[model samples]
Target chain A: MSFPKRIIKEAERIVSDPVPGIIAKPHEDNLRFFDVIIDGPEGSPFEGGHFKLELFLPEEYPMMAPKVRFLTKVYHPNIDKVGRICLDVLKNNWSPALQIRTVLLSIQSLLESPNPDDPLANDVAEAWKEDSSKAIATAKEWTNKYAK
Target chain B: MDSDISTGFTTDQSFDAFEDDGYDDLDTNSVVSVVAEEPLSYEVPYTSLSHEQLKQRFVSSVNQIQNLCGLSHEVAELLLIHNKFNIEWLGERYLDNPARTLQSIGLDLKYADYSFAPRLLPAPPNFLCAICCDDATYPVTFALPCGHRYCASCFKTYLRMRVSEGDIRLNCCLNSECRFPITDSVYKLLLSPSDYNRYRDQLIKLYVNCLPYLKWCIYPDCTYAVECKVNQADLDHIIPTVECNDGHKFCFGCSNEEHAPCICRLFAKWNKKCADDSETANWINVHTKGCPKCQATIEKNGGCNHMLCRKCGHEWCWVCSGPWSEHGTAYYNCSRYDEKSGQEARDQQAKSKASLERYLHYYNRYANHLESARLDKKLYLRTQKKMTDLQNSTSMTWIEVQYLANASDVLQHCRRTLMWTYAFAFYLERNNNTHIFENNQQDLELAVEKLSEMFERNTSELATKRLELLDMTSYVSTRRSLLLKDTQLGLLEGRWKYNLSN
Candidate 1:
């Protein structure tokens, strides 16, 4: 298990009753660790392709946030190609009041509503922001070529 | 709202100053008025007297009489009752010796009653919390003749807990002001059936009924306050049942003036703020619903998401208006100077029209996006709470952790160099002060290229990490639950307990 008991516990409930665009399953050996999938929100450039995600609990557990990274190579305003996130909970703004379940749901929301205004991958964000159609096309093409 | 006879006498508030004056002795025939009417305001002269002589006349002491009767204790009193001359000249002429004088009048009056001296009467005893005073704690009760209040459990405990725990002597616990304990005689006054019943009623109304409870503001700020619930009865003017030192009072209804501000109006104002913020965001859609370049609000707009900004004379895709302009046969007027050729002036007007449309489109979406984002943030916080709670009961664990070492480092390196990239966008996107790339053209290009390369390389790797994180979160709870249960069972089944002995 790569996750704390607290995070793994919440993930179980979410998986059993998955949200509309969110899906998940355990990684290889560690029950604590797991792989998740998210279909881009409808009306988004990432639509139709299944995007992958990685999640696990840290040693500090509930007091800290879980580690979440994107697995799909698709371009997004918030996520860099390397799958790193620019979410608030993952950085300086993390509060002890947050947990894994809230964090993942927040990430799912990020996909549905990417903030190109605060870009993580500047070029992809630029492409997305300046010419959304081209960005959407690139996102869809990447989804087909890699996510499948 | 029944009979609105607000005479202020209803509670602590009095109707007017006409009250509490000499209303009790309205008729002048009473002897009590002789003294009460003219209070000697301590400015009168005094004849020196030996303390011994004054004590002999009082039978107790002159000092006691001076202190109790509101006479200045520092001055020696002159005994003038022996031979009174003028009405105002003799202090003793008014001072009647109740035992001797009232007896000669054939009125059977006890000195204790007639003298108006401060006598230790068997005051009605009551009980309350020793700790919180008026708020009685059970078990430590004591009572008075009024039988109004008694710390029943605590009184007994006071007797028992006395020797070792705290102060041995226990006093009355009604209000902090009442400190006399109930003696045997005082207890009887409490035993009086009618008085005891009356006391209990008073206790409930005075203390129990006016107690504090949970209260929170309904405003967006949602500040919480703690005060007696009865105080909120006139919610519009949150007049506390009791006033504090500083004369600040509030009306609960409007959270304003003590009694006047209308809460209904305040609520309406609060509602308007909420409504205004919402429509403001929605309004943006009307202004910039389409792509600035091609005027495509949704995908079904036209030939492609490509278009040219003929007004500003900038060219780009209609879908997003990216900086890289596509070469096209588009032409428009440019109005750049105060004095220019006729052809140039015409170009300016045409170009202005096109730029204006693009600007309006971009502006609308930009504004709309912000309002929606604010609303979304609010909703997210609310929903996030529910999901976090769900994780606890379901099968979630916070044991394992996955690293984004490779991916984060790549993004981090790119972040260090984005300043120049933004400069390029700034320069390309604006005409004057907002130009970033123009200020550092060469550096902007290099930074953009470098950052783009890092992003392109990291995309696939980051994708894997994102998937890993998602999957870990998905089933982590179920797996955690089983493990936790197993560990608990193992401990109960002589594993941890058995090992502890060693």
Candidate 2:
């Protein structure tokens, strides 16, 4: 399917905005690769440090969800150490009407309140499932140590 | 023939004999006399309870009926029937009274029970009241959903404050989410005979028939005190359920919209003409409400969840769909405080504060100097006047004695002189206080005079220089008054300046 103009415009906007928790930057002057940051929301264990992720908009945008993956090595239910995201919007739950802006926003919310019931990274998912406190502390320490 | 005559028929043979004797011409008075001569009456009429005595217990349950006559005819008849069927000796009580017209029933007083209505008091008996220690006749009875009755003033104030405060979620007047508000109509029913008597003493009293207009919304979802104009026809009572708060009566209908006939028999006919025909009606069952921005068709799905753009591709949450992701579909993003912007604002404030402090310092320096110079000029004039007064001698006191020994009230003069020196010292400190250097010499001389006077021993040297400056100052002033060229006494001020080393 052909890429919608609105989708391209939205992708451009997300990159331009230096969001606090999430940083979105273009890959080598192209609209395709966006390196974004997701600071955990306040009052949560993931708060204070940036969590970097990659946003690769497909040629056929809006009609298909963006290819969002984590760049930073992290312990989370949804994201693996190799920058793979396990969100429905990025996977089988992808809808044709969804756009790049919405995809990034949903990822930010996921980082704020991670759901471990459906695991993307099995080990991290299991730890999150078994002991949520240890998982949150580890995630926060990783943010301070790596994502300065 | 004799038996027929016993019944006042005089008999058949007697009639034949009369016809033979021409008795057809007998007088009417003689006929009454013949009938009256027949002996005593035997039929005794039955009696029933008097209308007034029995009516005392009957009160119409219907509001309109009781308002018109003291008692409902239906209830009155039931009272009469009860007396006839259940109580004995009621009939004889008022057998001769005109008001005992017929029984409450239009039957012979004996059969009144068959035709009489059940005697019902206007308000149900159990709807008395739950709040008071004793019912106290419940001056302000308010019916609630649990069929419990509470003081009307108590509940009305609570609900009014709650509604006005926009506590729509607190739908129940009893402060329970499960309980619905009592209906105004049922509240009126709670207005028993004794309630009217007590209504006068309440803190917040309700007027007659005003309770219905005091309609709390019928929407179990929203029992708000709806303004009649705004509510249109959606007004309801405080309690939506029955066996009202008092647990006395149950409204047979009106629980939900599905129940077409409500328990109160109070129903509203909704005309869905506006929304029914429109394709995009907001309220699924009612009329259409268009989108605010585009005037496009709008519809609310079962939940406040889904969104579809009819025109602008603008999908949003029904709750507060105000630009979540600019053009995104999810309502997850927040209106970030953008601390970076706050940092910029704080930086601006700090910069202004630094500049303002510098400005205030400049004003403080200049303000001090201006005040000092003004006071010094006044002190210079007063010293010249004192020198002139000392020169004049009117009394016979010797000059040597005035100058030495007892001296002219030296203690008092010393005190006044010390005060003047202190004032001069204050001015000198003030003038030298500023960073500017042009006024330093005058300030130093003034300081020397002020400090030198405080030490009376060996102060002779400072005092000799002070007297020298004073004589030079007076010479300049007198010469100026004499129209002579100005003398150079300003140089003496430079010479008398204090040496910091000393």
Candidate 3:
């Protein structure tokens, strides 16, 4: 029924001193649930777009990684159509020391550099591998059409 | 009296005979000497270690590494685990350059000055545990050489979580960039007693799995591991059947049941073929014919020779598979026996049918022996009861009635060996050596069946037929070893040729 001090403190810190291009605000009813917005990094194909994501701290949070998924549609090889991001820190590489702020920063960096080789979307990865410029062009088009 | 009964049931003398006949090209005296000393020729030499015995081995290896490398116990354990308990490899690398090996395994010699053991110290003023964000909860804190300190409670939780996840390799610092390993002492200091025990069990499993020579018995709740020096490359020639401490026999090569006379490769292939739909495809190939025009598979069910393709509406004669118009006068019958095209089609059909029949021939024998072996196991259980009844009814003691139990064991063992011979024969190409192998197989099967039939007699008759049963038991066991010896020698000499591509 009650959240841990770590989750409460993390929630307080992320809101009070937010990352430059990110905003994470916990819901009033449930302190463990947060509505997140990450601004696309400059110089990336996803630039100038605001991607919405949802973060939920599981019962084993801090011991386990928080479950996060994108609410907005994004065109990236690593991000699947259903908004699952294939990032190492979100899975096996997650350390208990990593907080919500660090996880968000990792996601933002992931958007800046989409890894096609270890992609969650197979077709998108294949297209990215075959033609990079066209893949970036399509990514930009989707960002404007959907992420706006 | 006990020694008399034991000698009467022993197959050692016959095994020596097999050794002489099976390996005549080798030094027969030495081969006979070994078989006469130990009648375990068919089984690979292995030592089964219990949990405590394995732990003792682990401790001794850690001590050896520690004394050799002049490192502390915890650090030596870390090195051993990182090198997968390979003492020789670790020794070579450490002797070549200690610092490099240490750094490569993330032990960094620079941190060698810090104690690898976890120590409880008072937390610094206003210390914030980065892990749990708890600034004031715990008075004591723990930190590795990396100085990424966290509260003791938080450390306990993290280590417990990692241990429960079966991760014995714990990083020293929680900082993702730092790769220094947390020593076993730290896990012991932080984890609860039960969690620490679980961690040690997992570590032992990791050790057993890492070494190529050791494998845990695959049976459920089996804590024993068999140490065998059999080479992986020799698995094609040697079956490497080893028994655990609990008497569960299994092949050390693939961890499957003891499948002697059948190499692991062919056994696996046979299993996959039986499990897959390849046999179903064979069935379709035997029974179904494709339409000439549309290629739809057609199975004739009480139809005349003149056929019509349901999909393409093309008329054809089923017998010759030629156009119906060509069979103008021969309405229901086909007379195109010598036509080249028709003959080719017929040959293809006959080839598939033959192939299917060939597979079924071996498969039926294999399945029958497997079922019979299982039933023989049940009969052995009943023989134990029969042994007691014979002891009560006759003047014989328990040791004297042991012949029935021994006979049942030989029957089961021979039936198992007989089962795998069929699978072995299926892959064998036709050659003179194969004929010899088949003859050996027939001898073993016949001996086993006779012994099994004699074993089924009433307990009252069993006491009178004790000598007969013991003789048959010894004979059946000798027949099994002879077949195994011949197959083993044949595998080593490359005398047997296999149709492996099939």
Candidate 4:
């Protein structure tokens, strides 16, 4: 089947004007699939680290949001092990106007300010809630160990 | 005689003559209580509306809203749909703040003016579609009121996906920030004719699903909707058994087959309970008897009267569970009645046994009647043919034999009432009022069995027995009303004094 033109345009635009600290490049074999890297936001526990993620545009692209998962492990309450993030824009908040560029930026900012209140990982959130400095120390340790 | 024989032959109803069925063990005289109250009467207030009637009512209501609100039919429908199709609620909301109510449902009336141009103008030359970013020629792009243009192909794909998602509301501009909703007129001009039909169907389904009084007909493969015009306030006190135009009967309140006497709440609770653990309860009741020693339930396989409780290791006769030496298998007499077992021990045994007996009694009757009702329904077709035969063979018109149909209907009603009464009795505690209720139940049971026996007779006998069938049907109907009325009273007035543990 012919690829949807909107996806091709979004892919082209992502390559033309790359967002700072975020790199997204579509796969050579499948333009709908992309490999992305996000630089950790400064001063965050994840700072000085790089996180790899994968994004796939389903056949219902633009109408349905793309499926994204983190390939590199990170310590955060909202992002579960196996890298499933619980961000609203990735789900019901998504709209056809949202493109690869805007989505990656949202994920990058999500790393900087993690909301432990509505978290996907209970143990991580509980640890963060119990002691923030201690939890951030563990996050920093994990970032250096796995997300390097 | 051949036709009469054929009627009985074709009918699969395994009903037997009342005298032949050896149920005379039921003590009729003792069961009928001496209660001389006024005759009971109940009106199952319901009707079946034709498909055309349902449509006419909806169309008129839509038109009324359109004229009152000075909005298009689709917008009025959307407003009503958002408000759960409660037109009164819609009117009150509209009266309070019209624009806010419309805006809340994603409609901006100002955009309606943009749709005045009857036709969509094609895209300008060298125009780039915002969605696809395609350098498309004129006639290949469609634009909404917000001036957000996308290639026609892209717009169609987006609309198709959204429609399939089952939210048939109007589509908004593709741009995330644009709040302008596309008008139905614009959609019709852009979409292909077949897609347009699907879009309208989805819209109609959305309308029907949200409407407070409209429900899709429960009949399989039927697309019609059943509309009930009863006052919403009265709906709580009444169970409207609506028969859709396609001959599907369902309770308006619960969308289940008509369950009279059992209110929708109780009916739902009973269904959930039955679906949960009824089969297991039935198996235990049928196959197991409690160990006389430890009170643990025990199932007996191949064994004589002499037995031993596996848990307690107490040796006793299975029949009376007395001392092992008391059993004499000489003639299969297990044991003699022992007065030595203290009254306290005997009383506890009697109490538990009585509870089990009560449950088994209700459950068995309930299951039996349900099975009978199923068989009777199968008999209806054969009875119809038999009625025709009787009409042909005797000096009777089609109308004269139509009593057979009425008899079948009355029988079904009695069966359903009897089935639910068991569920009612299951929850009820034994009280003075329960005596009268049980008497009423017995009366209905007798009448149902008699009518069923008559129904199973040969056509010649049935023709000759029309008067008996009619009389039995009326008796069944009256007794049913009494049981249902008394059950309802017991439920409302708290006469049963429900034993929560039971």
| Candidate 1 lDDT over residue span B139-173, tens digit each | 43445432334344333333222222222122232
Runs in model 2 deviating more than 4 A are A1-4, A15-20, B1-502
TM-score (chain A) of candidate 3?
0.98
Assess each model's interface with DockQ, reporting 2 decimals per model.
0.01, 0.01, 0.75, 0.58
Across A70-131, the per-residue lDDT of candidate 2 in tens digits comes to 77667678888788888886754454335566677788888777888888788988998889
lDDT for each residue of candidate 3 in B1-502, tens digit (9 for 90 to 100): 1111111112333222222244434432232223234544556777778888789889999889988988888888888898889999998999899999888767777654335656988888878888777655578898876788888888888888888878776455677777768888788888878888999999899989999998999899988888889998998888888766565678999989989999999999999877899889989988888998999999998768888999999998788788889877876678885778788889999998998899999999999999998786579679889988998999987555655655666677778889999999999999999999999999998888888788788878888887777677767767787888889988888888999766
TM-score of chain B of 1: 0.17
Binned by DockQ into CAPRI classes (incorrect, acceptable, medium, high), candidate 4 is medium
lDDT of 2 by residue, B1-502 (tens): 1111112112111212212234433431122123223321210111111222122222222222323323334323233333432222333433443145333322234432222221213334655322222334444454443444455644554444333433322133342222333322332343454442233112112111132322322344331222122122332211122111111111122333211111122222211211243212212222233443565666665654335567876654433333334435444433433435335534554555554454334334434433444454354444334334434432222221112111111222222222322222222223332222223323433433443243232323323343343333233222221211010121112211322110
Clashes of 2: 33
Native contact fraction, candidates in order: 0.00, 0.00, 0.72, 0.66
- Please write out the lDDT profile of model 4 over residues B1-502, one tens digit for every residue: 1111111111111111111224323332112212222323222333344444555666677677777777777667656656766777788778788778878766665532232342456677667766666554646677765677777777777777776676556567777777666556656776678777777676666667777666776777876666665555554345555555444556777778767666666567667765687556656655566777788888878757666788898777655556676554533555454545534555555666676677667778878977877886587787788888899889987656766776776787679778877776666677777678778878888888888888889888888988777777666766876776676555556566555455
A best-first ranking of the candidates according to their TM-score comes to: 3, 4, 1, 2
Best model number under lDDT: 3
Arrange candidates by lDDT, highest first: which order?
A: 3, 4, 1, 2
**Lowest summed-lDDT stretch of 10 residues in model 1 chain B?**
B7-16
Q: Model 4: runs farther than 4 Å from truth?
A: A74-82, A115-145, B1-74, B86-99, B102-118, B136-138, B211-214, B224-240, B278-354, B486-496
Q: What's the residue-level lDDT of B327 in candidate 3?
A: 78
Summarize candidate 4's per-residue lDDT along A1-148 as a digit string, tens digits: 4576777778888899899999999998799899999999999999999999999998777778889999999899999999998988788666677888888989999999989999999999999999999999999999999888
Global lDDT of each model?
0.40, 0.39, 0.82, 0.70
In candidate 2 chain A, what residue range of length 10 has the lowest lDDT sum? A1-10
Give the runs in model 3 whose Cα sits over 4 Å from its true position: A126-130, B1-36, B39-42, B110-117, B122-124, B134-139, B145-147, B175-180, B301-304, B308-315, B328-333
